[model samples]
Target: MSRRVVVTGLGGICATGANVPEFWDNSKKAVCGVSVRTLKAGDEYSITLPIAPIDGFEDRLAEFGRDMARADRFTQLAIAAADEAVRDAGVDFASGLGRRTAAIVGTGIGGQTTFDAAYLAMLKHGRKPHPLSILKIIPNAPASHMSIRYGLNGPAFAISSACASGAHAIGVAADMIRSGAADAALAGASEALLTYGAMETWKAMHIMSDELCRPFSKNRKGLIIGEGAGVLVLEDFAAAKKRGAKIYAELAGFGMNADGKDMINPAVEGAAGAMKTALSTVGAFDPAGVYINAHGTGTLLNDPTESKAIRDVFAAGADSLVVSSTKSMHGHLLGAAGAIEAIATLKAMETGVVPPTINYDEPDPACDLDYCPNEAREQRIDLALSNSFAFGGLNAVLAFRRV
Candidate 1:
């Protein structure tokens, strides 16, 4: 029989809040994380306004006055968040042994900060970069750091699927437990791509917000880029119950797909495919019984397309279901979006209150579905779906049920 996997702990460090509790409380208030950028020299790149940069963030992490040489901001995020998760899950990796504990973290842009710094240093001084520069710059560095730090003794790997990386990492880790690869797994994604080149790349796309991110709004402008990380502790149901661990929620199902036709644009068929697959994984589930955390980047192309896809998949509950975009409060975390949004979904389940999509001034014709606009609402949701669709037509959806 396939083993059951459930979420025991959640850790998130993002624009919303540092820890899970703080993050959940702030999200309940619909606090927008978008702010002005000082790095761009007065609107420097592709996405200027409403950029979600982490404030008071320490890129250099030194626990005992000895810094991890050449560590990047992205790796720091993973470490911080993972520390919280492992602690919350009550697992001591240093003392524990032979339990098949593992880690699977995801990243879309790995060490962009390290890569940029190395290039500039070479140009300015005409000298070779630091020896650990490459080690800090790899996409898998975050996952590697996590495993080394925690001393997990099972399989460890990194998942990269644009915005879908986090969800894929978590889902795949759950399967590891079910298939006897590990008794538990730490899963999520970390990303800090607020570098100059990342900003320039978004600017080239011209799909960033000028004023602010406005999801499900008629006057919606565009999306705002942000940075952060989120991590989760997933363990076999029997093992967690044996340990008397507090259950946060059950990661009921996961669905993923890519648009075969487009490199930049999203295909509606692929979107529907992912949603349908997610719903089908859990058999005869009612769509209205759950809340939804939308990707809702406030882009013209993404918002409407997402709305239509949801309607098609949940036709049974399209009119009454509550769906909102926490991105209005936390901004878009790119590769980390899925994991952070998953935390939001779990928060709604725990608190019994669904957060809102802020900045909803006017309603878009295409985005006519309910978005639980402008304020938090009281709702006892048992099941919830989080949607994240990224560039290159990558789409992922995860369904979580209250335990």
Candidate 2:
């Protein structure tokens, strides 16, 4: 028999804040976190870009009892977020519950900091890399660290599907619980690729915006890179209620599909299909009441394509649905984007205020919808959808209903 899954706790750190409450508060106010930072590329060239980075995160490593020099930035961020989530959930890991718990994290480019440091040392400084570099640089290090810290013995692994990684991780964790493979799971994603090398590489892609992100706006430029982590404590619904856990929201359904048509370009059919599958899993609801946490990267193509997909799926009801992109404030956290955005969605459900998509200059005719722009609106949302469309045409959508 299948089981139901619910989000018990949320933890996240981003440019806007170092925890979920702070992130949500700053996001609702449409406070922009993108800023210009200058960093040494390779002792020769310095690069500056509008990027969102967490400040003073290094000091947080001491709380986890981890060696700051050994742990990769990504892993540190994940551990911090996971610790906050586990504490928020008030789960007793020592009560043999660890055996039935799992840890699943996602990252697009894991250990980029380690790789960049190793290469710079070897190529420029003629120094050999640290012996533990391999362990720290691997993509699964975050999951491993989280499992070890929390004593999780059940299924533990990592997903690396670019931007969709976080949403995919949560979906897979929910499936594991529903399938009775695990009773609870720590699921989320983390990314810390703001190093000089990583930024230089992204600059070559020519998609970095010089100004702030403005999704669904006619004057939108492109996406800004951000760094942080977002994690949720997912538990079986019945078990959570029995234990008197404070349930945040029900993770009702998940849907994903691949375009299989292009590497970077998005297809409306694929996007619409994913949304339809998610909604169908939980039966249909009034489309007008659903709020969408859009995968709005403020790019030239994503906004219009996503708007078209919403119209395709919801038809006339799409005109009443509210859609907003928190990325306009937090910047795109890459693999961590969906996880943080999911937290934003849940917080919206709890608070009855929909966060706005900031920096909206002018509306595009192709992207006409009720995008809560510039200011937070007072609206109670019972059901919400968080969309994550990755660069490789991979799309993942998650459905959440207020409990």
Candidate 3:
């Protein structure tokens, strides 16, 4: 028999805020968190780009003590977010429940900082790297550290599907609960790729924007790289209700597919298919009333492709459907984007206020839709969809309904 899953707790840290509340507050206000930062390529050259980095994260490392010294920055952010999520859920993992809980995290470029440092030490400086470099640089370190921290013994793993990593992680974790593989799970994603090497590579790709992110805007150039983590505690619906947990929203459906055609370009059919599948899983709903947390990367291709996908999926209701990209405010969190955007979607449902796509000046005709631009809207969101389309044509869509 299949079970239903619901979100019980949410915890995240990003450029906008340190936790969910702060993140939501700043999001609702449409505050731009992208700022200029200097990244050193080695010891000689430095490049400046607008990035959304979590401030003061180094000071918080002291809370975890010596054990964290060996973990990478990405894993550190994941552990901190997970700690908040566990505490918020009020789940006592030590009381036999730990055996039934799992940890699944996602990362696009995990431990880039550690990798960059190790490469520089060995190749650039002709010196031996740190002994723990391997442990710190692996993409699965976040999931492993999270599992070890909470003593969770159930299925634990990491997903790394470019930008879709976070949503995929959450979707897979929910599937485990529905399949009775686990009663509950800590699921989310983390990214700390704000290293010089990572920045240089992104720059080489010609996707890094110098100005602020302007999703759906005609003058929009590209995406600004950001780093952070977002996590949620998902529990079985019956178990959560029995424990009197405050249910945020029901994770109603999840759908994903690959575009098979291109590496970086997105396909309209693929995006539309994912959205259709997710909504189909939960039966019918008023398409006009649905809101979309778009994977709007402020790029020329993604914005219009996503817009066309929504139009194709909703057809007549496309004009009434509201879509917004909080990435315009929080910047793109890459692997962590979907998880943080999921939290924003649920918060919008809870508060009856949809966050806006800031920096939208002139909308392109190709991307014509009701993008809640520049200001928050007072609307009741009965159902919402969060879209994540990655570089390798991987697409994941999640559906949530107000409980």
Q: How do the residues 158-241 of candidate 1 rate in per-residue lDDT, one tens digit apiece? A: 888887888888878887888888888999998998887778777788888887888889898888878889999998898788
Question: Clashing pairs in model 2?
Answer: none
Q: Is candidate 1 or candidate 3 better by lDDT?
A: 3
In every candidate, how many clashes are there? 3, 0, 0
TM-score, one value per model: 0.94, 0.98, 0.98
lDDT of 3 by residue, 363-402 (tens): 7998999899999999989899999999999999999987
Clashes of 2: 0
**Candidate 3 lDDT trough over 10 residues, lowest sum:** 280-289
Candidate 3 error regions (>4 Å):
none
Per-residue lDDT tens digits for candidate 2, residues 199-240, read: 989889888799889999999999999999999999999999
The C-alpha RMSD in Å for every predicted model, in order, reads 2.4, 1.1, 1.1
lDDT of each: 0.82, 0.90, 0.91
